[model samples]
Each structure stands twice: as C-alpha cells, then as structure tokens.
Target chain A: MEFSSKLLEKAVNEMAQLPGIGKRTALRLVLHLLKQPSEQTHYLSQALTTMRDDVKFCKNCHNISDVEVCEICSNTSRNHKIICVVEDIRDVMAIENTNQFKGIYHVLGGKISPIDGVGPSQLNISTLVSKVKMGVIDEIIFALSSTMEGDTTNFYVYKQLKEFNVKTSTIARGIAVGDELEYADEVTLGRSIVQRVPFEISLKNN
Target chain B: MEFSSKLLEKAVNEMAQLPGIGKRTALRLVLHLLKQPSEQTHYLSQALTTMRDDVKFCKNCHNISDVEVCEICSNTSRNHKIICVVEDIRDVMAIENTNQFKGIYHVLGGKISPIDGVGPSQLNISTLVSKVKMGVIDEIIFALSSTMEGDTTNFYVYKQLKEFNVKTSTIARGIAVGDELEYADEVTLGRSIVQRVPFEISLKNN
Candidate 1:
C-alpha cells in the first residue's frame, strides 16, 4: 500500500516483518499508534528495545530471566529434583498458568526440526544432559508438544540421560479435559484407551 | 500468563496494547522476536520511535508528510483547484492506488461522531473551509465512508463551503462493480434507479 510519508512507510515495513502481520495490518497498527499519545509509542519501543538488549537466560534451565537464575530455578519451594522439559518459554508459561506442575522447567528454545534447519546441537540439550548426569535430578518429565520434532527431541535427550540414574517420563497424551470422547481423534482416543490408568488414580483428581 | 522474566512480561504487555492484539498473540510475537537476531528488534523499535517522534503533517491538507507540504499537495501535475475531502490518510492512499483522481486531498482525520465524542472542532474542518474560501477552489468531492457519521460530517462541511463559489459533490452510491443486482439492498437499488446515468455515460467507462 502507498504511504504519504517515508517515516510512516518505514515503520509499517518494520511492523509487517513480524510473523502473521501483513502490510495492511501493520499500517492499521501504525496508524493507531499515530492517533494515540506519543508516550504510548515511546513506552512500547523502549520496552521492546530494553528487553531485547538486556534480557538474560537462566544459567541452569535456559529460560528467559532478568537475573542469572530464573525464579523457578532459584525458588526453594519448587521441586528441584524434577525438571519439566518444554519446547519454548510459551510452553512454560502455559504449564505454569495451570499451576499443576511444581517442578522447575528446562526450555529447549525449540524442538529438533531438521526441516527447519534446527538440530539437537542448536538446542540446550547438552546442559540438560549435564544436569541429569550431575545426579541432582531424580526425574525428567517431557512436556513438549506431541509432534514429530517434539518426539525426536525427547528421544535425543532421553538417550543422553539413559546412562544416568534419573527416571524419565512424558506428559500424558489424551483428549482435552472438557472435550467429548466422541469428538476425539481416533489415534488419540486409542492411545488414551490403551494407556488407561487404574480407576482409583483417575478418580483422585476429580 | 506468568513470565519467567519481568522484562519479557513488560515487552509483551506493551505489545498487546496495540489495537487487535491480545495477550496470547502478544506472547507469540515477543517469542518470535526473541528467536530472531537482536538487530531485527532494534530496527523495529527504532523505526516506530523515529516515525512517532519526527513525522509531520502537511500545512495545507493535514496529510502526513516529512516536509512542510505533502507530495500530492506540492505536485504541480495534480489539480489543486479540485480537492477530494477524505476522513484520513488511508483514503488518500486508496484513491492514489486506483490511479483515478489527479486532485489534491484534504484529510479531515476523522468524521463527526457524537457517540465517540468527536465533533467538528476536533477535526481539520476549519482549515478546509478556509482553503475553499480562498476563492481558487473549483470543486470539492466528498470521498468519506458511507456511514451516518460520514454523512453528517460531509453535510456539515458542505454547509461551511455553501457560501463560497466552489461546487460540491458526493461520490455515487450504488451496487458495487461486478455485484449481482438482485442481491443489492433495496435502498441502494432504489437510489441507483433514481440517479441512473445516461446510457452513453455509463457505457463510456466500460
């Protein structure tokens, strides 16, 4: 789309570079910013730049943090003996919002997707294996998505930790909590059936 | 959602403040930025900040510009005597893209919407009137949207320019090009019938 001002065009171009945002959407966003108080734009730009330039990753789990160690890694209340392996920080956020997992998180930053040029070496697998080999972690829970890349990463990490004494497990694959069984895909329904737990264990949560 | 880093949370919150963006989408965008090189973030922030801080509006038409006058207003090839009145810069861009009009534009910024607390004084109406009253303007085309507020603003501006020598006209209202006549709304169909142009006039464009 044509823009009257070069500055407006540049801002729109930069905004449209973001994933899922097209030129029309970028123009609408930039125009919205132009209508708002200039302070809002300044705050947004300042916050983004500050985060990008100064943010750090936790030394232990590779999760984003302001300090050397993330809150979960530093907290004494969380279960340090268990680490929930996740594909990225968003997964950690999603799992944290559930308040179901009390263990610390190991953010792999990405999964092992060779098609996307992302391999095992590109992730934080080495540090995790080293952590497991250090003998502090008693169990490693794989909380990655149920995708091929997620499975590959899980297997790759599992192989590295196999020599260690730690127990490895994966999060359950089943229909979502509120979903109807009839609506569940056949593969997922079959897997859930085959992996059905004892009646007493399933009743405990409810 | 809980974030591992305070800076990441801050950046996501700021990003979500933009129109049409929600918390989940904001997190996705922030995480995407985290995955990219730092230079991309810097370019985005710098471009937005610079545009917000330095962009100017044309002195005559209130169109966004880098200099005192916008390109359309300054161009000698455009018909300066015939001005198209639009609600905002986007309309100017749309008309420019069509390659139909060679006239300069007067961007009102917004329409007269009492429900939204926008009044005539809040818009660039006075400057438009003064431009028309300058005695050089030949015709004023109302190219605003076909909404109630647009009609009100057009009528209000038309009243202000009525005492002047300039002729006023509104863009035609009819079934869209290539639209099925049977499916056209009754009001629009009736208007099209009453304001039907001569056969030669309608056939000339095709």
Candidate 2:
C-alpha cells in the first residue's frame, strides 16, 4: 500500500518488522496511534526503550529481571535445588499460573533449532550446565516442549549433566483435562497409555 | 497474568493498550522483542516517536504529509474544479487506487457520529465550505461511507454548501464487483435497481 507521508511509511515499516504483524496491520496500528494523543505514543515508545535498555537477566536461571537476580531465584520459600528447565519467560508464567511446581526455573531462552541457526551455545545452556556441575541441585526437570528442538536441547543438556549425579525428569504429557480421548492424537494417546501411572498415584495429586 | 519483571510488565501493559492486542498477545510480542536484538526494539521506538512528533497534515485537505501541502493537492495536472470530499486519508488512498477520479480530495478526518461525540465542528467541513464559497470549484463529490454517521455528515455539509452554486453528488452504492447477485443484501440490491444508471452511461466507463 502507498502511504502519502514518509513518516507514516517509516513507522509502518518498523511496525511490520514484528513477528506476526503484516503491512496492513502495521498501517492500522500507525493510524490508530495518529488518532490518539501524542502522549500515548510517547508512553509506548518510552516503555519499550526503557525495557530494552535497562532490563537484566537473572545470573542463576537467565530469566528477565529488574535486578541482578530474578524473584524466582531469590525466593527462599521455593525449592531452588529442584530446577525446572523451560524455553522462555512465557513458559515460566504458564507453569507459575498452574501453581503446580514449587521449585525455581532455568530459562533456556530458546530451544536448539538447527534450521533457524539456534544452537546449544546460543542458548543459556552453559550456565545451566555449570550450575548442575556445582552439585548443589538435587533434581533437574526438563520442562521444554515436545518439539524436535526441545528434545534436542534436552538431550544436549542431559548429556552434559551425566557426570553429575542428580535426578533428571521431564514434565508428563497427556491429553488436556477438558479434552476428549477421541480427539487426542495417536502419539500422545499411545504415550499416555504406556506411561500411565498407578490409580493411587494419579489420585494423590487431587 | 503476572509478569516476572516490572519492566516486562510495563512494556506489556503499554502494548496491550493497542486496538486489538490483548494481554496474552502483548506478552507474546514483548517476549519476542526480548529475544531479538536490542537495536530492533530501538529502531521501532525511534520510528514511532519521530513520526508522531514531526508528521504534518496538508493545509488544504488535512491529509497527512511531510510538507506544508500534500502532493495530491499541489498537483496542477489534476482537476482543481472538482473536489472529492472523503472521511480520511485511507479513503483518499482507496479512491486514488481506482484511478477513475481525477479530482482533488478534501479529507474530513472523520464522520459526524453523535453516539461517539463527533459533530460537524469536529470535522474539516468549514474549510470545504469556505473553498466552495470562493466560487472556484464547479462540483463537490461526497464519497463518505453509506453508514448513518456518513449520511448525517453528508447532509450537514450539503446544507452548509447550499449557498454556493456548486453541483453536489454522492458516490453510488451497489453490490461489489466480484460479489454474487444471490448473496447481495436486500437493501443494497433494491437501491442499486432503483438508482440504476442509463445503459450508455454504464457501458461508457467499461
């Protein structure tokens, strides 16, 4: 689409650089900003700039934080010995929302996607490995997704931690609670059946 | 949803204020930015700030421009005698894309919507009226949408322009070019039939 103003075109071009936003959506967003008070746009730009320039990552788990250490890592009540390794901060939020895990997290930042040029070194894997090598942690739970990259990262980390004698596990996979068994995919349903827990064990959580 | 960091929370809150973006989508976008290089976020913020802070509107038509007057308004090749009044810059772009109308445009910025607190005073109607009173224009084409607010705006402008001797007309409404006749709505179909043009006039455009 042709824009009458150069400034509009520049803003839209920058906005369209975002992951899922297209040129049309970028145009709509820019126009919406034009309609709003200038202060709204100022606040949006200020927030983003401050976040990018000043945000820090936790030295322990590589999660975003305001200070040197993130809240999860510094919370004394949580079990720091048992670290749940996940992809990013969103997964951390999702698991926290469930109120299921009592341990802290190790944010890998991203998985090992070979096609996208994301390798093990590019992620926060080395710090996690060094933490495990310190032998303070009792358990290391692999909480990454079940994708190929997730599996690859998990395997790479597991191999690196083989020298250390710590318990390693992964989050269990099963059909979602409200979903029907008939709608479950074959791989997941078969895995769920094969890895089925005893009746008492399953009933204990509730 | 809770954010792990205050900075992340602030950025997400600002992002969620956008038109269609919700908390979840905002979180996703914020996390994506965190994953990308800091320069990308810096560029986005810079572009938006510069656009909102420095962009100018055309003196004659109120369309967004980078200079004192917009290119379309200053182009001497276009018909200065015919003025096509529209709701916004997007409408001007759409009509320009058609390449059928050679007249300059007067962007009203918005229609008259009492429910939304918009009135004739909020629009760019006064300048259009003053231009018509100058006795230079021969015709004024109302190309606003066929909504209640659009019709009200059209009537309001028409009343203001009654003292002038310029011929006033509205763009025709009918089923879209590629739409099936069976799928056409009753009101539009009936109106199109009632306002049907002469066979020679209809065939001339094609």
Candidate 1 CAPRI classification by DockQ: high
Residue-wise C-alpha lDDT for candidate 2, range B18-59, written one tens digit per residue: 999999988888888888899999999999999999999999
List, residue by residue over B1-206, the lDDT tens digit for candidate 1: 78888899999999999999999999899889888999999999999999998999999899999999999999998899999999999999999998889999999999999999999999999999998878999999999999899999999999999988689998899889999999999999999999999999898877
Q: How accurate is candidate 1 locally (lDDT)?
A: 0.92
Which regions in candidate 2 have their CA more than 4 angstroms from the true location?
A163-165, B163-165, B198-206
The local lDDT score (0 to 100) that residue B77 gets in candidate 2 is 99
Q: How accurate locally, in lDDT, is each candidate?
A: 0.92, 0.92
DockQ of each: 0.85, 0.79
Model 2 DockQ class:
medium
The predictions' CA RMSDs to the true structure, in order, are: 1.8, 2.1
Per-residue lDDT value at B124 in model 2: 94
Report lDDT (Cα) of residue A67, candidate 2.
91
Write candidate 1's Cα lDDT for A6-68 as tens digits.
999999999999999999999999999999999999999999999998999999899999999
